[model samples]
Target: MRTHFIAIGGAAMHNLALALHEKGYNVTGSDDAIFEPSKSRLQAKGLLPAEMGWFPEKITKDIDAIILGMHAKADNPELLKAQELGLTIYSYPEFLYEQSKNKTRVVIGGSHGKTTITSMILHVMHYHNVEVDYMVGAQLEGFDTMVRLTEDADFIVLEGDEYLSSPTDRRPKFHLYQPNIALISGIAWDHINVFPTYENYVEQFEIFISKITNGGILVYNENDPEVKRIAETAANPIRKIPYHTPEYSVENGTTLLETPEGPMPIEVFGAHNLNNLAGAKWICQNMGIDEADFYEAIATFKGASKRLEKIAESSKNVAYKDFAHSPSKVAATTKAVKEQYPDRTLIACLELHTYSSLNAEFLRQYEGALDNADVAVVFYSPDAVKIKQLEEVTYEQIAKAFNREDLIIYTNPVEFKDYLFNLKPDSNGMALLLMSSGNYGGLNFDEVKKLV
Candidate 1:
């Protein structure tokens, strides 16, 4: 197969390009600007575009397919040429579906926890030598590539995101999968730019549940009221399995899972992670992994990257970084860290980076998100707000929305860095958490290590 990609330097786009290239397909791609990791990875695989900008001439008649990435604009020249040639164009998820249509597609969907759950399932399958095609959002320890498409795998596990598919395809990416097996971890209002209203955002998940194949299975988190309600009301003719937070205890910083055999100590901690693990276990069982094997493999799984990842640790201070930008995720992460180290003084800093988090109207959702921490700090860049073309937000607006009079807020990166560096953590234990989809204006982690 000969495939060409428009805006292929994206995280998902680049990974898919590499996967197709690995599958022996002649792959070529173009992008206006490519950043680190994606830039270097594509270069290593010889898949990086020769020059940065799109060349309409590259869209030829002989090309078998064009995979579109969300990064490309609707009026991209290459896309126009592809359309002019009447060539088959597929969005990233559409192409994924085309490749795995013959196999059992297990899609994990939710506002959050989808990445961690999908990673856990893949990790267990790898541990048990269960060969399968897969696509997950985050980079895992054992996986070479985030995406794998094969001719012989009986199943394909997909990390189904509710975000838009592409510039041309406005439908949520997960809507195209039409899975034979699916899981919805939880639903919280997000992507305010696209959905506009909470009701509109939730309708996407309802559509996702309806897309599950006949006689399929849906594994959901029973503990989440919204997820449980959605799973029950759906009229799909599928067997529904409900999972809740499993029995566990955090002893001296190590989290132990209560298993039928005995207490199993695991590397990952937090109630949200444990809930995700339960959902992954149900999906793994449906994929042919027995209970004993699932627990055994999961015991060794660390976690997906950037989901409560420990970046710096010491006797006096421990710091973590996470990809949490929404209100629900922010609250869960803050509570998780504080619970794990009850004796420590938790100082949490959140970067309001994503469109939803930075919006003045959306600010109220985070009213008590950082309440678990002893001291809460929120950082956002006015330049970022301008870049996203959002309405300007003031310090008073943020402070009022969070409803915490004692909260510290920073709009300048330099001042934020100064506050972090000047912190005088005593010999008493202290936990520091940094949460955002983007860095706090490119804050240096090396300097963060000196907090102790």
Candidate 2:
């Protein structure tokens, strides 16, 4: 089949292009610009466009389908051409549903820990040599691509994002997947640009729960009142199973599971991750993985990329870079690190990166998020605010919002890095947790790790 992608240079879109290309489909795509990794990977597969930007001439009746990425605008030229041609258009998630309609879909969805939960399930499946089609948001170890689709696989595991499907398709991406088995790790308000209000944001999950196939199973985090309510009030008559953090203890900064088999050392740490593992376990169990087998496989499942990922560590000091920006995420991550190393003096640094985070009104949501840390800092660029076309956010305003008078804020990445580098060696234990969805103004992680 001939498939063309609009805004295909996106991380997920490029992966989809590559997956289709590998599956022997004729894949073509266009993007105004492409970044590294996606660019290189697409180039390696000879799928990179000879020239950048849209060419409506490329659209023709011969193409079987047009896949749209979220990065493109509603009036994108190629999209206009595809609509004009009356070609069958699919959002990435829509295409995924089309491919897996015959298969048992297992979708993992939530504001936080969905990627980790999905990754955990895949890890167990991979460990047992189970061949299942899968899609995850992060670059996981032992997986070549973020997305995989196959003709013969009877099961497909998907990390179902709550983000919009595409510019033209306003529905949440997860809404497209009518999963036979679904899991929600937790819920926190995000994507303020799309949903706008907290109530509107919550209604998306309600819609997702309702979208489950009849008699489907729902594994949810009972700890999250929102998720609990959704699962309880779900209109669909589905088998509802709730999970919370499993019994686990931290030993020397490593999380050890309290299992019937005895205390099992696990590669991943954090209460939120333990909670994620619990949700993943229920999903895997429903998919036919026994409790013993799941426990064995998860022990070696270190972590998903950028979810409290260890950048550098020593006996005295350690550093972690996490994809945490939301108020809930910030608080959860801060507490997780502090709890893991009770003796360590936690120094939490966050970059106000996303649109919601950079908003003046949204700033107040961060109250008490950094209270777990011994030292707290919030970094945001004036240039970034201008680039995102947001009103100016001041350090004083941020401090007031967070309700921390001692909080240090930075407007420059260099000065921020220098401050981090020049920190006096604390006599007591110390842990540095850097959190953001965006890179701290192109700060080199490797150099920062080395500095740590």
Best by lDDT: 1
Go through the candidates in order and give the C-alpha RMSD of each one to the true structure: 0.9, 1.1
| lDDT score of residue 244 within candidate 1 | 98
Model 1 steric clash pairs: none
Q: Report the lDDT tens digits of candidate 2 across residue range 1-452.
A: 99999988999999999999989999999999999999999999999999999999999999999999988888998889889989999999999999999999999999999989999999999999999999999999999899998898889999999998888788999999999999988888888888899999999999999999999999999999999998898878899999988898888777888889898999888788889988988999998999999999998998999999999987788899999999998999999999888888899999999999998988899999999999999999999899989899987889899998889999998899898888764787679999998888888888866655
Give per-residue lDDT, candidate 2, residue 444: 82
lDDT of 1 by residue, 1-452 (tens): 99999988999999999999999999999999999899999999999888999999989999999999988998999999999999999999999999999999999999999999999999999999999999999999989899999999999999999999989989999999999999999999999999999999989999999999999999999998989999999997999999999999999898999999988999888899999999999999999999999999999998899989888898768999899888889999999999898888899999999999889999999999999999999999999999999999999999998889899999999999999988887667889999988878989777787785
Q: Residue 55 deviation, candidate 2, in Å?
A: 0.9
What local distance difference test score does each model get?
0.94, 0.91
